[model samples]
Target: MDFGANWKHYDQAIIPLPPDHPITARTLSGIPGPGTLRIGSSGWTRKEYTNTLYPKGVSTANQLTEYGRIFQCVELNATHYKIYSPAEVQKWVEKVKNKDFLFCPKYPQSISHHSSLLNATDETNAFLDGIRAFGNQLGPVFLQLGEQFSPARKATLFKYLESLPEDIDFFVEVRHADWYNNPTELREYFKTLREMCIGAVITDTPGRRDCLHMGLTTPDVFLRFVTKGNHPADLKRLLEWKPRLDAWTAAGLERIFFFLHVHEGEHEAAFYKEVKEVFGIATQETQMSLF
Candidate 1:
């Protein structure tokens, strides 16, 4: 989330709606079914959530249950650091089983960073096997390439992506500028992902404007929105996305997972509801369940 955290200055002006890429539009225009959406924060058990998201004395073990009552999905950042056993993942899944909730797990660094998406079959399999426990509760698993990982490694990256099980949805986020700096490479990136049926993760952080590359490789979109807590620009920036999202839905978008990176737990739910209201998504903020 710190990808754009430093140097406190960004355009508070609303970003305009972007024109769809030829490939994305062509692919979406053929789709006929309406799309679905899920909005949530990166995680649920932050210490800051004490009296807000969680009851003042609620135990950590029950936070997920409490969160399930409020949001429709969560970005599973925990999976990025370590692969948990299926039983553990199942325990988490059980907490939200009856709700229309989704767990969007991140690929472990072991496969994406240490191995750089090369020769890490064991790690990759372990991660997938563990997350599969989520069953219908699982959303797209995103492979976030480090800033050092550039387009030069596309062969290995593409092969690794192709090897992923088709039953499970996947998305990719590239950090290096090379992927966007070269127009040919940018188009190729979208073409490659589209042909393979993988979605793209659009990262919106102030420090890195290029990361906001607004092209959808598939009908689904995974956006990682980094926030400036309590900043007026936060709501303005998010409001601007509503139109772009509407445009995509018109084009062919079928699913969207918008994850927020807000630090203040007390105000997180409020912000979540406000933003979801902009998109006309109903909020469960009134749900009284506490665990």
Candidate 2:
């Protein structure tokens, strides 16, 4: 969660950026068909969510079940720090069993952070083997390269991505600024993802507006929306996304995975409610109160 903590100072600062080009949507039109949209927070194990996002005295072990009662999906951030065993992954699967929930797990740090995509096959295979325990419940596996990872290592990154099992979905989030600033590299990066059918993660944060490159290389989108604790600007930003989402859905984007990151757990639930309202997604009543 502290991946981009350096930008925390910009939480209250607003930067105006131009609207997304229609051409980007036009390019995304090549996607085959319309996809389902899933909205949820990063994780559901926060102790602070006890009464606000979870029922009072709700056990930590049961939070995922409680969370699945409301949200359809969650970004499994725990895997980003350490790889888990198949048993552990299965435990998670059972926790959300019988619910229409999906888990988008981040790639293990061994593959993404420690090694920088070089000779990561062993670690990648181990990570994937564990996550595959989710079976049909597994969503996209996200590989978030550290900010130090630059375009200079694009070949290594691409090679690693190409080696992934084609049956499973995968996404990549590059934090290096050069990847966004260099026109040729950006185009090539996306073009390669399109060719490989790998989804590109679009991160919407305060300081790094350029990371909000509305390009969809695949039919699906994995959006990381970092909020400033339910700030008014947060709602405004989601409102702006509503129309774009509609357009993308209409234009053949298959699956949309939206994960909200807020400083407080209550803000996360509040924002989720607002997102559902704005997008007209239905949800059942839950015990969590956003007060």
Candidate 3:
């Protein structure tokens, strides 16, 4: 009974997956079905994808080819960093399909970082509509609001979300500590999200609870697993975190999609394989990274 010991290490030996683990009938159904399916990495643009897929002299097109051979989805981070033309997204959507890949675009930085919530205007919708070339394969349109925290922002955000079609899955990721500091206001903001049936983004960062505590209040779960390191110690932390993710799956939420983001995608490939093993995603191919 080491009650005073560090509880973080308590689950170090606890296996993340069960021996009897099998892919759920639901996941099988989602292989082509709609809800709660999809796991991938963030930002596979020219640089990140090129570096990850081909560290040395890997042709850009060959890199994407390799990516299609591996990951089924990628967070379209460039969408936020720049205003992409419709032609660009269309070309992207046309490039890959074999692995049933999907794209989740982040809201543009102009809309999120520079303006007040009340000032969203038609920019967000226009941006999304511009990329309709992806169609149903568009996955969730992630609204990653940055460090701006205010009631006005929340209200405007809810309005912008309300404007989107019901078919378009929306996910909200707030980075500021202000929202988490006041649980009541946070829950209230989440209440708007619930009413709109929007999924809240579950971010696993350093020094945080990670999972959403107010799940009963929301309809869906979209996760972004940004690992700060790929060390064995980090792997152990990730193993410990899986049970908590399992708890979300158990809660019967609408969806779950995790993207691996760390320093070394090549080495982290092994750790991700272990994660897939733990989670019972029994595809033997280590598809997320290029080694």
Better candidate number, 1 or 3, judged by lDDT: 1
Q: Write the per-residue lDDT of candidate 3 for residues 1-291, one digit (tens) a residue.
A: 111123344334332322211212222222222235466776554464454444567766556556665666777777887767788887777667553677888888888777644566677667877768677678788877755555546767777778778877778877566676676767676667767777667655433442333343343457665553445555665676566555545644455677766655555556556666666674645443313
lDDT of 2 by residue, 114-155 (tens): 888787777877898899898899989888999999999998
Q: Which stretches of candidate 3 lie over 4 Å from their true place?
A: 1-37, 45-57, 210-219, 282-291
Candidate 2 lands at a TM-score of 0.90
lDDT of each: 0.81, 0.79, 0.60
lDDT of 2 at 33: 61
Candidate 1 worst ten-residue window by lDDT = 282-291
Q: State the weakest 10-residue window (summed lDDT) of model 3.
A: 19-28
* Root-mean-square deviation (CA) per prediction: 3.3, 2.9, 7.5
Error of 2 at 37 (Å): 1.6
Candidate 2 — which residues are off by over 4 angstroms? Answer: 2-23, 30-35, 282-291
RMSD in angstroms between candidate 3 and the native structure over all alpha carbons: 7.5
At residue 166, give the lDDT of candidate 2: 94
The number of the candidate with the highest TM-score is: 1
Give the per-residue lDDT of model 1 (tens digit) for 73-99.
888999999999899999998887455
lDDT of 1 at 13: 36
What TM-score against the true fold does each predicted structure earn?
Answer: 0.91, 0.90, 0.76
Q: What's the lDDT for residue 260 in model 3?
A: 69
